[model samples]
Target: MIKLPTVSLAAIGYEKFLWKNITELLKTGMLIIGIYYCRKIYKKLDDLQKKIDKGEQDKYDFQKKFEYSLDKIKATIDKGEQDKYKIKQEKDNIAQEKDNIALEKELNKEIEQLKKEIERKKAQFKSAWREIPLYADWRKEEFQTVKLTLDAATAHPALFLSEEGRIVTWQEPCQELPSSPERFVSIPCVLGQLYVSSGRYFWEVEVQDAHSWDLGVCRNNVARTGRVTMSPQNGFRVIRLYDGEYWGLTSPETSLTLKEKPCRVGVFLDYEAGDVSFYNMTDESHIYTFSKQAFYGGLRPLFRLWSSDSGPLVIVQVEENTTML
Candidate 1:
């Protein structure tokens, strides 16, 4: 309320003065009451706010402690999981080592057995009746040490001759002899030494026809190069007969005659449990072998025939002491 000037001050009567004093007293009383109540309410509110703030701080503290504990528990669990994994890996490594040891032992046994066979063959060298070249010059009987050559047999038919009267030659007049496994087998080498090592080999050939020419492991004759037949009816053939190189591996008890070309042909040895494996000599990556067959090498007068004509067969006397690189 606007403080109206006390109109009683201008009044000349005693009642006016009394009215002015009463108004002033009423205004003073209101001011005192308002101040007292306001102070009391503000204090009460301040106290209530302080209590709420304390409760919130306690909640925040509890939350922080709970979060810290959860983090610690997670870390412990992770560490335990890592420990378990480490233990498992160690166990696996131990098992693998044991397995490797066992495999090595088996390989050693096989090596020893092979050595014994080699020794026996060496002992029988002199007594063995092997076929030497019929030529007058003994040096002519030696088998040529083979090396890779750029010359490839012309893309003509492979001529073959049987021990029987039939003369087989590949050409326009001669119909390609039916590729029979029996016809293309390896003939035994009556003389000379055959050596081979076990390993992977890569075999690569550029041929017009894969079926016409049989390439794989073979035994006996140089003609067939001891190639394995490519069919279950026969077997997989890995022997290669072309320019001049001849290579193959023979297992024990299997007898074979490594004759020169023209006489190159397949011969069946009396190997009851002989095995001859053929591998790619260049890269040493592919392997072909007979599952169950007899293996033999001796001085028997067997010759390998390459072409059907006997003219191409060169009888060379191979020195036993010479080493092949």
Candidate 2:
């Protein structure tokens, strides 16, 4: 280095002092800049903390809403299941009722069929009893056989009775007979003298020669003075043969069909049983029966000749132990 001039102590001290001052100034400037930058960083951190807190609150609300939605979905599912179970239960009940109705109908049908079968069997038994052999002899032995005859006191004006009171015939001109309370006025009829109150008896009448006749049981106190309708209600349970047709003189007359024309008719009475039955002696076949009659006191055997030209009807006297066949 070139030594030009001599330096003073004061100048050196001054230069040193100046250098120290400048160094201190530079340090202070750097400290101030650091402090400013630190303040800015603190502000940014505070803003970031606020944003984090807001996001946390938002997350909490969203979680609560999601949980509530899940619970609602679960309740809806449970209700749907409950409704489905109830529907199934009702359906099962309806099906059971239908099955019960069907079973009842089947049982009712079976009961009706059984009743019809029983009735048919009863009718068959009755027919068999009539068709058996030796039945006439058995009836004569078992029951009373009466030789019934017409009462002259009960004969009509136009009817003529035999001496033994066993035959009745209608004549053209009515006789001037003495008036009696028991005599038939309008009807050409006659009755038996026996007052049958109870018990069983049978009689036979020959009807082959008679063109038209009426035969049946009647009440002992029946109408004999005036015009009368022959019916069960009118105290007459009779069968009529008019022209060529046979009919039961019921309230509504019942037409009868016969397999063979009846020559001799047998009347069987069961007083206690309220039955009056007729049979054909030729074929031994049952003709008809008047059943369940409400007889109060007594009954009588009635006979009627319809016209003057009607042939004679004879009462067959059945001896004891005699066979009708």
Candidate 3:
């Protein structure tokens, strides 16, 4: 047989040692690579934690700003309520002032009306006191003798005249007197015999128990044939009594309110002065006056009676005054 070379134990041990070193190097390299990978994982987890912390901080800041805005809104609402209350109070004050002004105006108007009424009453009392004494002096100066006699020729047909012609009474339709142009036709009236053209004269007439009568003077040419109104426009100036009322026979008849009715009436005439005055002889009080008239023609005393039952109107003769002006 052919024989080969033999192997040693030391070479086998060296190969074993070399293999052990190479295995140790590989375990060390694997441990280093595992440690590097663990560090990369830790870095990635730390970045994620930082992002979560930043998000929490941003949430906290947003909550703080929202709370501040809510506080501002709450403060504005409180101020608005206070301003509304103040406006309401001011409106109430203005309304009350308007009512007070209206009440003051009504009180002032009533006070003015009362002042006017007090002044009117004072004037009436002063006028009555001044008239009493002035009438007494006028009666003494005007007293005189005047003889009035009725003319039968001019008397109404219904009149009954005394023989002396001093009295006239109204009677029913009597025998017609001779129709003359100067006689009254349908009225109970008569004219005086004496005509007065000038100078002052005084006369008195008794009208006792007469229901109605007219006493005055008329123009001698006055209408004696028809019924005539006893007015100055009809040439008569007179005082009349009818239905218990006295009137001054003027163009527009004037009513007179007398304190007393006179049984006897006195008449005074100033022909040149054109004044006619009447007096109540029972009380010596002046009754009325016809002032400043124009006596154009001759005037005669006139009389009118209501009826026969009304009683006669008598022409009274006064005694002549010895003490004369």
Candidate 4:
């Protein structure tokens, strides 16, 4: 502790010298000096220690509060993320529900339409049966012929006789290039009919060697005849015929590598009004035909394969009106 100034009452006792020295100002100075020294010493030691403790406690408290606030803020952010996820999930669920409903409605509509179609077909069948009383006995006649295989180069080629007895000659590739620079000689029929009926026609050829190619009748060269040519590129195609005045029918719509092996393909023609149908000779199921409208003029209703790629062509007339009746 700090030593304070002590002023005694004897100093102010009433002795002549004491009374002379005992002034009011001296007494007040001594008291004020004792109080200031004691307060200064307290502040330097114990009071300063209390102030430090208070400051540390306040800092600790503030830190704890800050940590709690951070936790709350983090919790709020997490809640927002969770809410977003829930909203997306809800939207997805709603979309799925709508899709399911639409699908069900479409299926129901299709089922009803099918039922109506079935009933209509059944009624039409009954009506047709009633109209044709001799339907069961309606038998078609069949015709047989001696298929001819002719050599057009050596012998004057015999013209193919149609069911109508009209001499119909098909243009075919018959002669092979005799010279070293080999080229094929194509024989094509000049067609007269420009219009066709809605009917199916079949033709066949027996190829012993590689040289058989059929030439189709086209209206004009303007109707580009697509052909999958011997060219490895541009596959099977419809080639423009006679300076673009006709069309050349290619067997396969796409061309494949030609093999040395002998193979035969059958050609089928399905004519419908202005439409001329064609299919691959290898498989009749592959229907590929050009529209008559696309032709410059009209389709020449006649065709023949009379050329040779390497050898002679042996064409067999398989279909006749007598046999097809």
Query: Stretches of candidate 2 above 4 Å error?
Result: 1-120, 131-138, 321-325
Q: Relative to the true structure, how large is the alpha-carbon lDDT of every model? A: 0.39, 0.81, 0.77, 0.42
Please write out the lDDT profile of model 4 over residues 84-181, one tens digit for every residue: 99998999999998999999999999999999999889768744642342331121122222233332222212233244432334324332423321
Order the candidates by TM-score, highest first.
2, 3, 4, 1
lDDT of 1 by residue, 90-155 (tens): 999999988988989988999899899888786465223222232212211222232211111211
Better of 2 and 4 by lDDT: 2
TM-score comparison, 2 vs 3, better candidate? 2
Best of the candidates, TM-score: 2
Q: Estimate each model's TM-score.
A: 0.28, 0.61, 0.57, 0.29
Clashes of each: 75, 0, 0, 42
Q: Candidate 1: how large is its RMSD?
A: 19.6
lDDT of 3 by residue, 1-325 (tens): 3221123434555534454565676678778887788777787778877888888888888888888888888877777777777777777766766666676677667666666655555544433432464453365465445667999988888888999889888878775689888988867789988688877778888998887888999999888765677787788999998888998998788888777788988887777878787877777666777757789899999888876676888998767653333
Q: Under the 3 Å rule for N, CA and C atoms, how many clashes does model 1 have?
A: 75
Q: List the residue pairs that clash in candidate 3.
A: none
